[model samples]
Target chain A: MKKMNNRSDVAVKYLLISKDGNALMEIGEKSAGIEKQIKIDGYDIETIVGFPNIEKKEQIVDGIAKIIELLKNGEKIFNDDVLIEYVDMIINEKSIDEILYFTLKHIISSNLAEKTAFFILNDKLLKLRGVVYLKRDNEDIIFENRAIKSCQIDLSNRGKIADAMFFDKVVTVNYSELPGKNIERYFDKNTIIIPVYNIKGVVGVVLLEDDGTKAKDDASLRLVSRLVSLGINYSSITKQLKLSKEDVAYFKESIEVSSTLTHMGKITASVAHEIKNPLVSIGGFAKRLERYVSDERGLSYLKIIQSETTRLEQIVNDILTYSKIFNIKREKVSLYSLLMDLEEFFKDELMIKRIMVKINCPEDLIAYIDPRKFKQIFVNLIKNSIQSIENDGEITIDVERVKNGINIIIRDTGDGFPIEIIQRPFEPFVTTKEAGTGLGLSICHKIVSAHQGQIWLDNYDDGAMVKIFIPSEGEV
Target chain B: MKVKKILIVDDEPNVARLYEDYLKDYGFEVKSINNPHEATNEFYMFQPDLVLLDVNMPDKDGLTVLRELKKVSPNVPVYLLTAHDEYKRNFNALYAEEYILKSRDPKIIVNLIEKIKE
Candidate 1:
């Protein structure tokens, strides 16, 4: 009898016990120079001498026992018919994680391989999607390792797994010849890499680290690959179906919102038109009576009436504007000249606040826009900045041309929006000022959206900041 | 320069009266018509140097009445007035002298008339 001193001796065979399972009858051994031979030949030995059985002393024992019993009855563990039935039962009812967990546990408990790992292939990138290993403490099976979950196998370099994926066939390489650090980290000697295929050809690969006893039959390994490929395909199809459903739901919602806006627009225009007639009457009479009034208090009352009516008229006009449909007229206009025009228009307001305006934009930077409509966005934002600043502050308009669009950032050196209003600044009727109609930002949002653009607000550096992105191509 | 007679046409009687009072105090001979159907008849009778025509009216479309007024007095400067600027785009092609938003102070009409380059 050999001394059982060599590492390969203990690795390939185990202690054979009597039927009573109380004593070891003999130490099993195999030919020493069989390294070059396929490990599949070892499966011919029917006795459980060299195989490791489930030793977990917990409720998990029943699951392991059932898998071992099925194998003992001469049923091939990788049989596609049996696996499809089992996979079908749990596939739809369980999450991908749970499915992977059950499949991995079945693989290990049936003694198909000592340890296994599943990799999801995306083109040349192999992501370590899931892994299963036996715990050394109680020999309980485990599914995922958080530390190794993000590990990726790049197929650019030559390795057994990459070779199997690229060649679309099975690859067997010794642990030392694994070709990459990540491959060497997860696998042991005599590791087999089998490519999993779908209708689209090879989609993934499985790494089986066998204990030198199981048959490495090509037919059985291919079947295992087919089974796993089915699971991957099912997961992907279900994910796409879920996304399609969500897209349909979103489409329905947008249609309903657009219809509601159209209805609201009609009502607002009619109401604004009706309110304007009364406003003209009240405002016109107030001015007429001011000339005939004598007392100082009477004069002040008349002034209030006139000013409040003007304010009411302004509110009505804003409502009409907000609900108005935008017929975008696209034009190629220089943004610099537009800002300069606004600065000139608001010269008096800017001067009164002692505000310094600095615009950082290319004089030649042109954007496709409706000049009249685009001007309204800047006018509202700049005016807000002016009103926010109490006295003597800087307002900066920084513009950059992006690949698909233009980016504009407006920053004001003033106290930012109040916290409550900042969260929903673009919503109608949200304002911090007492006299504000609160439709300013909403109108800006509407116009920017009409131009296939986006707008958002933030607070930083002791001021309020507004960022806007307008796509270069207008949706005319 | 005589009084630079101004004709005001609007559907609202009170609004028309208000403008008549303000423009009369500003030393302009102002006559207002509350009905659009009566506008062209008044324009011929009043023989005003300028016209302040409201865009929206109950009896008829102000743009149609504008065409009638232009036919008779093509040389006269007619300003389109409205509570909203929706009609601004149409005013230019119709050859109106200016577009006045009714939201403005009525005194603006006086100021615009005072600056007439007749």
Candidate 2:
């Protein structure tokens, strides 16, 4: 048994064997040539035996046996060709794992003297992905269960083929010369090693053993290289496809949110228009009635109408302000002045309601923000806190500078938000107040989000706190 | 003495009637029409000195009627009425002589009518 590189060499050598054995030889590339020659040889051999009466019976038996042997040999050759063909198809199809499994099965069925297995290079961890036995009887079971079955070699050995993959190197283990404990039980007494390489790195190694003369061959090594290259390319393409899908999903979600915000703006404008007219009418009529009425009782009623009208006007203005998309007119805004403005604006209202308003913002605190939008945010939060109190409640506005940003917290003495609303209070049209349009916190959320800040509601043991955190101007 | 008759046009009868009653109290003879289609007939009969027109109408938009009134009596001052500030800004760009928000107090309306007389 000698290592043969080409099919022609193997066929020629087979003919030489038949002739040397003193047998009548007939070998052709086609199956018919062999069949015809075998029949002629059977008849001639029977005549030479001098059994003319039994020649027909002997010839029939001998021809049948020769034909059966030829067919069996032909079928084995066909199977090898088909296996190679299947490996080529899988490579062309770019099925990495399938090619590995098929190649392993082919190596096992070929019954080469050596025990063989495949190993993939793990670039990230710089190690071998380890022995993928293609021809084990329980290959499917081990693959599914992910446990090493019945191989005496310890896979955890640091100096094995897997470790060599880290340095993009190949290790050839000749079992007859150096029988290492790492893979002694798996291989024959004689072994030869071959390395497989791709553009990225050394991919794997082939293990072979000598029976007599049929040992390691170049054709087998070349096939291994082709399989490794296809495997790497296929894996890369699959990874790219997965990333592209994620990006598409992100883009679709962004588009949906933008459309919803646009619709919200339109609704805000319409509501503002409807509410303003009636508010004006109420305000105007109350002023007129107040001026004409002489009774104190009539005056008080007029005052109540005037106060309510003012509240309605505030709500309309807030909705209009919040619903409009923020185009930050960035400027150096003094945080202290902004807070002071809010304090002054709410001073009279808080006094009237007997709600104490406290501020703890630093005088030197400043940020680059649209002053108008910033003012609106503060006014909304403060007004919300003031409105939350039923009677004799206090509101606190605190601003503090953190390492990378500023944090503003507005807490109220009134009862905290309902548990359900606390989780999603910033969603548009979600309100607990009977008169609220539920756009207050939503607007705050949008404004803060535009500034790349965060807004959240915190429920304390005593009351509710609304906190806003905005990155420092220079930091952003 | 000839009194200047101002025509108040609005879809809401209450709003139109309120302006009419208030304008009359301020010594301006006023006629009102809630139907936008009846605006042409009322304007022709009254020959209003100034027209207070609501921009949002059921049958005709205020700007369209403003153009029609201008064609009939170009010199008669047409004040376009809007309920929103954004609309007020838009009306400022139109050819109308004045734009007043419907939310303006009745006193402001009376003041504007007196100023037009002056």
Candidate 3:
């Protein structure tokens, strides 16, 4: 509470600070008595409005980091309500990984260093998840090896980096000052390692190269320090309050899902291998036998066997490929050109089925995404529409530009999705065709999701409809 | 112009035969060998402008053979043919001229080879 005295009515303290983080709770208990009376130079005042200090520091460095992040992007955040919303959005999330991802993005874009490596401690697993970001050709690239790999570190590690990680303290060292030869490999000549900690223990560490120039100023250092500290505290506090049990349950559920997917992929790959081997013979011999068939009846029958084998091979291949890692290679792909290419490729099939195709998109519609994955999404949706349609059916594709992404609607003149599983056709092995392996939509779902897009089955009286929305630059 | 020669190394006879047949139809001289261990020997004997090396082999993994083949004929362009699609395939195919999925049509391989030859 503010100490109002018979001194001056001219000054006021807007944000009040206390020992604990729960200043709002404290204000709730004291606001009743303070609001009733106020004495300033023997003059009565009308109001003593106060907001709680949500941070403990010599100065309020709490929201400054967020303000810096916002300002760096040229965003003007002036309204206090919007500021609180931003603060709540920043501090409320339970996932430290999400926060770190954004922080790393901001740091990289800030161009503060040549290389940065982020490590988050897994208290349950006793290991460090290493994330490395390198600035290459003016683009931030996550070095693949260090991005996917985890490192085991303890206090026994000799270098200054190990000191920072193990001791839960920040350290800076030069190339020559690095302790041992083995430890020398992990770091550059000059590095600053900072450890992030909470009430429980060490939570994360970030390594930044000194670059021999660009020495960090005091304000920036304090901001980084406080941001790290806040991130660690918020994550742990949220977990303690609401997520401790659910985290374990969610982990168990994901393990079950991934393990099941792995088992299915393994079996599918093996089966694809076994079938692919003999399929080569069957397909090769059928094409070879085409020369021997003279009569029209014999030739047509041989063609059926030939095409069937090819189709079967395709199904097996699709299943195998679907089960594998969908590595995304993003680029700026023109949707118009992609559609033209797809139209050309499918021309023969469309002719065979006697189907009419129409593309309702801008002449230069473009999106930043992996073209292959994008193609996969549209192709699967097209195929899903195709299978539902009979001969002479029509397929129309419409594209619309949304706030941050593009929305595409593919509608077909076939029976709409079955009423029961219409919502879950994206699930693996959910198909209407007798020959379908059911991985088509699932693969499409995976590819779309990897591109940070959403795919869903839409209902229309005319036929089956599938809608897709992909971000302009694959940003989520 | 001398006809472009192609070397196909695969464990599966039908696959090798399929590639051999398709490339020959495209008017390129082609040889099919099953054992990967014989790739280096075949490379010297065939002296082909291009080599189609299959990743899954019995005697030696395709990458090892690729290393040995590279040591012998450093400039002979090699195209990786693999049914497996894993990123670990990244290192194996890093040095190759191109990596083609075997599950794709044999025409794609022929097209890539002809394009490279041109």
Candidate No. with top lDDT? 1
Give the top-scoring candidate (DockQ).
1
Q: Which residue pairs come into collision in candidate 3?
A: A6-A41
Candidate with better DockQ, 2 vs 3 = 3
TM per prediction = 0.49, 0.48, 0.47
Clashing pairs in 1: A40-A215, A40-A216
Point to the candidate with the largest TM-score. Answer: 1
lDDT of 3: 0.64
List runs of model 3 lying over 4 Å from the truth. Answer: A1-258, A292-298, A329-368, A391-398, A401-406, A419-423, A470-476, B1-8, B17-33, B38-53, B69-118
Candidate 2 lDDT over A114-183, as tens digits, reads: 3455544433333333455432353431231132122323223334443333233334555544323335
The TM-score between candidate 3 and the true structure equals 0.47
A92: Cα error in model 3, Å: 41
Q: For candidate 3, write residues A46-142 as lDDT tens digits.
A: 2323312222221123334333443334323223333343234333453665555555544555555565656566544434556544343455445
Ranking by TM-score: 1, 2, 3
lDDT tens per residue, model 1, B36-102 = 9988899889999888888888668777777677657767888888877767654121356678888
Judging by DockQ, tell me the better candidate of 1 and 3. Answer: 1
RMSD per prediction, one decimal?
Answer: 29.7, 31.7, 21.1
The worst-scoring run of ten residues by lDDT in candidate 3 chain A lies at A19-28
lDDT of each: 0.68, 0.60, 0.64
Model 1, C-alpha of A106: deviation from truth (Å): 89
